[model samples]
Target: MHTTTEESVRGCPDCGSEIRVHSRFSAWCAACDWNVDPAPPEERPGRLARAQRAQARRHGEKLLTELTAGGTLRPRRDASSVLAYALALAVHAVTLAVAGAGIGFLIRGWGGFGMVPGTLLLALAWSLRPRLTRLPTDVPVLRRADAPELFTLVDQVAVVVGTRGVDAIAVDSSINASVATYGIGGRRLLTLGLPLWEILTPQQRIALLGHELGHYSNGDTRHGQVVATAYRSLVTWEYFFHPYSDVTLLTMTVNVFYALPRWILLGLLLLLDRLTLRGAQRSEYLADRMAARAGSTEAAAELFDWLLVSESAEVTLMREANGSALRGRGGSGRDDERIDGLWERLAADLRSVPEHERERQRRASIRRGHSVDSTHPPTWLRQTALRIGPPVPPAVVSETGRELRIGAELAGVRKTVARRILHDGYGN
Candidate 1:
């Protein structure tokens, strides 16, 4: 796909090696990587972030070793899992204790000065209360009646993965997809990012669905309501008790008083994170297995390849938005038509990426220990595990006509998302 014409080929500035221009990528030296990453490397993370990453990597490596040795992969109630649940229960108990204390203060005060502290304590308890995941109001929600074809495909995948089907689907402009439980009834919602969805082949799309829906059955500790809400409460406590940096003596004294509780909360948060880390990592691998089972090993592996290119996809989208804006400002294009065929152009660009460049990106990911997030193993490791694991035939298949219907269902929201990106710029 990347043809090297005289105009597109030049010697690298740093190593003097031949570099070929790519339409959607930076032309960098293959030998020296003169400009491979174009964007400046991100600033080093803080100490805590670094520590967390290190722990995740270590845990991921251990899991990978176990799996590669033919160890069974299933969620089990190990000591860490038990401890994690106990800690979550402890967190909830603390909140209840605080609420009881607040009630006692209110009863004892009965309209005296004590009422002030009672009210404050009650407010703190309210702030720390467990919260259910809520459906985002900003995105479009598509029910089964509205997008029967899409829901049907999702339902098929769910059956293959042995989980209950989602109650609704949410569409957004993000480059990722996820599943979450929302409301008191715990309804399942699948959020599809149109940018990612449009670029995927129908089978790849099924793989994406399989991966997300797989989370529901994979025993991800972080996704469970109790642990999730406990984490949130700890975050709230950390924020409230965070030390002020002001230099005044009064502020210093207040910080000293806040320091002990803040440290204690931080310790609990880290301990919970540590306890759940192994289970969280295992769940991701299990989800990947579910994806392979539902969509075939080939499609699942290709899905990870697509993920490796998502950063480039994001950069391309931003560039497209900027170009459209400049064209509008220069009167070279009508405002209404600025974003026309945007998704088409993006898919075309990504599909045209040459194999060599893809390999280069894969190698880059390995060198950098890149992952989807802290919870996931490195992309290379996941890909490797899929290859080493038992071969899986697709349990859920995509039909061409159904794929078309699903696209048709998403058409209107695609336009709205395009306009939002053009007006607000990418990554808003």
Candidate 2:
């Protein structure tokens, strides 16, 4: 997949040491980390941002310690959890109160100029109403009839994780996967990112599915419509009270009048964020355990290792697409042929990475406290937690023939995604 040559070797400017270049990655000195992250970190964040980061890191570390120390793995209904739910209910109550007031106004001002305020209040109430998550229409959605093998595999994993199987599977070009609920009935949807799927071993694929489905079994309240919609309502309130930008006396006076309410809303939003943060993080860890239970600890741990290289994998795909576009200028047929092999080349490139490089990336992740997001714990911690206990045998296995059938089912999606990248570029 990758071959070393004189052209691929260079001296690191910072350390003046030889650095071997990877075909899919930037050359950097592993010893000194020269150009490891070429772009500078963003400018110092605001005080609130700094505080939030600090709080998240503290929670992550605390949880890691508790897990590694033989503490309970399941989430407990602690005070924070109770308070978070109470606050969410309070948010819903406020919206209901606003709606009631709007209806009263509409009734009282039915035949007068007062109808304007009534209408405005009703509009505000409607805007704040709880919303259902909807299925994304842009991606390819495959049903049981279309991809029976894949759906069956997901069903097996769901059984292991103690959750209902997905209603449909969606394929996209991202290097990530997720499970979410949609519609008023809250039907489950599984989104599989083809880039990530192509590089993983079949068992690792099961691990990916296990991890996503585990959220459903883990009781992650953050995903519940009640809390989610409440958060959205707070965001809407903040937007409505946000200071105006127009440079005029009237605008300045209006901003001054709204400043107090804006600050109050901001406080509420931050409070809700903090209250939910711990439970969300715990859910992620519990989900990881479920992943281990479903696909085996080894497979789950390997999945995390793959995640560390996801950015590199994405960059390699983009580079390949760009190369295809450049070659297409000479002729169309050759570029089309190369585009067909994009996934194969990507899998080969990632699989061929040196162990030393993988270790370096893992260490770097620990140093930087890398995570998927603030709602999750550090990748290194998650990986470490998986290894702390005895290895688990997979409850569900991926058979070779079944895997091939699933691959055949996804062939059309793969081609469509490849062509889109070739034209629209990666991360479009």
Candidate 3:
């Protein structure tokens, strides 16, 4: 009574019923979400053929993973760390000597000498620490159970990669997260900022964890930590030696002689900061590729955008707070607000530029000197890199799986190291 037509009915691969497919390569049955790709096109393959193919694929994957694993620890000789330490130490020492000379002048009841420099150095330490400075926290070690919402995502990803979850994830007030390995064969610590959690989505959070783990997996954590320790050791010396310096300027005739050395010290510190930022940005890019390779492009992109937003917000809040705090402090309120304004203005300028142009500017800054002072790359470059995907071979899926495994081992090592460092001491 009726004739079938191609427009009215299409062959259903699964149920073999006449059903319409709305899109090309529609693998799901309309009535059921039955996947169709693995279905045999002809007679089902015999057991022997399937077994041999499966075994060969598994063997090949194992071999590839082993080969790549060996390459992960290859030393990436980034000289920025060495340069930064040298610069920081030189600057710090000079600044301390000048401050000490001022102290010497004060002790001798001079018209001027020690009071200003002593006040400046003391003010620098007090104003910067805990609030504005990048000092490590003395808060109790944070357990995963304490912040289940944040740590769960980290743990889930670590589980997938086969690593023990982090021992503790710190929540700094800053807008960054960093992984540190104390020394050779030491424990690792992953410091997460409270601001970062507020800005990132669950998937993005997972991707970030993956990225950090990538650094650990590739032995970047250990290298970075060794360099960081040397830097910190120098800073400690600056703090300690400033008060003990030979600033016995018992004469007002010799005050200007010390200012030059102080200025040099400040300049060197700034240079070190810039160099550190450059190395950090490159490491961040490497982590981004690792995250993407693990199948989370969307997560990485979203995270990058969120980080940019958080940074913008932080800049805004710091400016507003500084305005209120220093309203009567001789307009040194201007100094506090200057850095905030610089970042806010830079972020605004970036918004006005085209995405690609902004990316070029960011990269150029890294090449000239490290413009990003955080432990992450610029958001624009990170987002752009995610769009490009990992540059590895097409067996990238297997590589992803392998990375996951390596990440797990690395995470376990990190957690163990972190516990030791936090509970014991860095030297221990």
Which of the two, 1 or 2, has more lDDT? 1
Worst 10-residue lDDT window, candidate 2: 39-48
Give the TM-score of each candidate.
Answer: 0.91, 0.89, 0.42
The list of candidate 3 runs beyond 4 A from truth reads: 1-75, 78-141, 144-156, 159-164, 181-185, 219-223, 236-279, 311-377, 390-428
Q: lDDT scores for all predictions?
A: 0.84, 0.83, 0.47
Best first by lDDT, ranked: 1, 2, 3
Worst 10 residues of 1 by lDDT: 1-10
- Among all candidates shown, the one with the greatest TM-score: 1
Best by lDDT: 1
Q: Write the per-residue lDDT of candidate 1 for residues 279-312, one digit (tens) a residue.
A: 8888888888889989989999998888889987
**Taking the tens digit of each residue's C-alpha lDDT, what string does model 2 give over 171-190?**
99998999889898889999
**Which regions of candidate 1 deviate over 4 angstroms?**
1-40, 329-336
Which lDDT value does model 2 have at 79? 76
RMSD of each: 3.0, 3.0, 21.2
lDDT of 3 by residue, 1-428 (tens): 11122223466676776555322122334343344232323422643234333333333334334435552213254676567656545544554565565566567645666567666665554432221123245633456555554455566555554455666655444556777544234555677654454345445556777777667654343235434543453444344433323456543334455455545544443455455654444455666665654537777666655553453445544543454345433454554444334333434532433343223333433332221332343355456555652443211122344445533533433334333332343333
What would you estimate as the lDDT of candidate 1?
A: 0.84
